[model samples]
Target: MKILGLIVEYNPFHNGHLYHLEKSIKETNATHTIAIMSGNFLQRGEPALFDKYTRAYAAVKNGVDLVIELPTMFACQSAEIFSHGAIATLNSLNCVDSICFGSEEGDVNILKTISEILVDEPNEFKIYLKKYLDDGMLFPTARSLALFDYINKYNLLDISKEKLLDILNSSNNILGLEYIKSILKLKSNIKPYTITRVQSQYNSETIESNICSATAIRKQLKDFTNIDSISSVVPCNTFNTLKDKINNNFDPMFDDNYFEILSSIIVRDINILNTYFEVNEGIENKIYQSIFTSSSLDDLKESIKSKRYTMTKVKRTLNNILLGITKYDMNNIKNIDSIPYIRILAFNDKGREIIKNIKNNSDVNIINKFSNISFSKDDKIFKTLIDYDIKASNIYNLIYYKNNRNLLKGPMDFYISPKYVK
Candidate 1:
C-alpha cells in the first residue's frame, strides 16, 4: 500500500485543507495518508488556535489515516528546521512513498532547482547573502536578494522573474522549497508534489465568499457567535463540529492570560532578555520598558519594532521568552540529529494497522504511554514542552467553562486506538 505524507498545523481543519488532502491522495495514487502535525505551538511562533489532540481528531475525521505530533522544538522554529523535522519524521516512517504540499508555484522542477541552490550553498550566493545582511536587510529579504542575483547572473530569467518573485514572496512556496531541500539533504526517495491553492489569500484578514483565509476566519470569530459569517469557507462536517464552540465563547489558544504571563516573565528575568536567540539588540530593555507601559501583546511588540527588527521576529523572541526557551535550549534542540520517537496522537482503524506494520519493521520507538516508557534526553525535553502544552490547554479550559479538565495523563499512545487487522 502506498502512503503519502503531509506536514500540517490544521489550526482548525477547513475546506481548503480537505481539498489538499483529497487532491494529494489522488495525484500520488496513495492508499493511505499520514500527517505530522504541530502540537501546541505553530511554525510562525504562535500558539495553535486549537489544541493538538482536538485538531488531530478533526484530521482523522476528515480522512487522515494517522496523526503524529511534531515536537515543539521544530514546531516553533524557522522554516528550515520545521521542514527538516517534518521530513525526518516521514522518512523515519519508512512507508511514506511521497510527500505532497501546496505552493503558489506548483512547478516541482523549479522548486527542486531552488532547493538544490539552497542546499549546496555556492560561494557566490554566500557572498551576496553576506553583503545584503551587512547592509542590514532581514534574513528573509537578504536570502531573496541573493537568490535573485544568482538567477540573474546565470541568465536563468526564463524561470520568469515575476513568477520567481511571486514564489519567493509566498510563505507556502518558501516552505515548500525548504521541504524539497530537506528531502534532498536526507536523500529520501519520496517523490514531491505540489497543488496550487485555490481562493483564500494566505494572510488576508477579510472574509470573502466561502473561501476565506484562516486570518479572516479568526477575526470573524472574535465578534460573531456562530460560524454563519465564515461557514462557506469550511467543510460542512468541520463547520458542524465547530458550530457550538464558535457560537458560545470560543477562545483561541493563548487568548487567555498569555500576555499577563509574558509580562511577568519579562519583568522577572532581565538577564534572559540578552540571549542570542533573543535577536535584535536592546530588545530585552525594550521589553522591560513595555512590560509596564504597554497594554496588549500587540502594543508591546509595536513599541519594540524598528527598521532592523521585524515584528514577526520580535513576537517570536517574546514567545521564546514566555516559554523560557533560552539560546542554550535552542542550540541544544538544533543539535538533535534524529527524532528520538514517534508520538502518535490519533489514528483511524487503518492508521492502527500502519502503526503495527511500522512497529514490526522499523527500529524507532513507538510511544503510546508516557509513563511506561523511559525517555532519552531529547525525549525528556519534548515531554517538557508537552507539559507546557497541557498547562496551556488547562488555562484555555478555565476561561470558557470550568469542567473536569482532561490533562494529557501519560503518553498519547496509551489512549490512542491500536487494533490489528485480521
Candidate 2:
C-alpha cells in the first residue's frame, strides 16, 4: 500500500515523462502513485498547452493513480516556492511513502547533502555568497558560485567546482535540490529519490527522438498545430487527446497568448504593477517602458531582462502582475508550512482507496469539489489560495479564446468536476 508521489506539470505528458513515471515506480517499488500537478499556469510562468483537467485526465489515463492541483500562487513561482508547495502537499498526504523526481545528477545523496548545506548556510557559506553578491552577480549565479566555493573549500563532496557548477545550473537539478530542501525544512518522513534525465535537456526546443523535451513538443504544436508532428514524442493518450482538441478547433496555449492582455494592463496603469509580487527594484518602470517598444512577449522580456533579473525571473514577475498576485498576498502566508487543501483533479479506483487512506491518516482538508471549500471558514489563506487558482483559470480562459475574444468561456473551475477514470 506504499503510495509514491510525483511533482509535475506534464504539459502534454510526453514519452520522457512516461519513462520517468515507469522508472520511478520501478525504482521506488511502489503500488500506487499520486501526482501534484500545476494548474492552468506552469512553473515557467507560461500557460500550459492544455487545460488542467485535460492534462490530468491524460496523466490518469497513462499511469498516475491520482492527480492533485498545485495552487496557482505557487505554481507560477520560483523554484523555492514551487517546491515548497509541492513537497508540503505530498507531505500532508500521510499515506505517501516516497517522492521521485528527474534530475541531471540523478543522485539523491548529493542533492540531499547540498540541501543540508543550503538549509544550514554555515558562516563560511554566507561569506562566499555575500562575496559573489557584492560583485554584482545575479542571486542564482552568485548562489551557485558560493555553493561551489563552500563545497570545495570544506571538502564536503569530492566533485570539482566545474562539475558542481554544471549540476547547480541544470534546471532539473536545481528543482531536485529545492525539493530536497523542502523535505528537510518540513522535517517530513517521506523518502526522496531521483532518476537521471534522459534524451533531451530541459530547455531544448528541437525534437530529435521519441523522448524529447516538453519545450520541443510545445514548439511543434505552436508551429504546426498538427498532432502528427508530436506523435512520436508523446504517449498515445496525449497524441489522441490533442488530436481530438485540434479536430474541434481548440488551440494550445503558449506564453505569447497572454502578451496582448499583459501588455495592455501594464500600459494602462504602469504604477499599479508595483503592487504585484516580484515587481521590485523598479522593474515596473522597465516593463512599462518596454511595452511601448516591444512587439511580443519574448521581445518585451528581452527588453526588460538584465544582469540583475534573469529572463525567467522577469517572465514570472510579469505573469504575477497579470494574475494580480501581490507581494502582500504572498507575505500574508509566508509562514504557513503546508497547502491549505488538496484539490483533486483526476483519479481512478486505486486513487479512491488512497483518498480513503488519507482521510483516516491525516487531518488536511481534501477538496473533492469546489463546493467543499466552504468548510474552511476560519482559514483566510485557504480562501486566498483557492481564489488565486480560480482567478488564474478564469484569466487563462480569457486568453484561450484568441480567435473569438467575444465568446469568452466564463468561470471554468466552478463548473468543472474532478475527472474520475475507470
Model 2 gets an lDDT of 0.89
Go through the candidates in order and give each one's C-alpha lDDT: 0.74, 0.89
Off by over 4 Å in 1: 127-142, 152-157, 244-250, 254-257, 375-422
TM-scores of the models, in the given order?
Answer: 0.87, 0.95
Q: Write the per-residue lDDT of candidate 1 for residues 329-395, one digit (tens) a residue.
A: 6676654545667877778887987888778766767766555445543566555545544443444
Clashing pairs in 2: none
Cα misplacement distance, residue 11 of candidate 1 (Å): 1.3
Q: Top TM-score: which candidate number?
A: 2
Per-residue error (Å), model 2, residue 320: 0.6
Model 1: pairs clashing at backbone N, Cα or C within 3 Å: 210-233, 225-247, 368-413, 368-414, 370-411
Q: After superposition, how far is residue 324 of candidate 1 from its true place, in Å?
A: 1.5
Q: How do the residues 278-303 of candidate 2 rate in per-residue lDDT, one tens digit apiece?
A: 99999998888889999899899999
- Residue 386 displacement (Å), model 1: 6.0
Cα lDDT, model 1, residue 62: 87
* Per-prediction backbone clash count: 5, 0
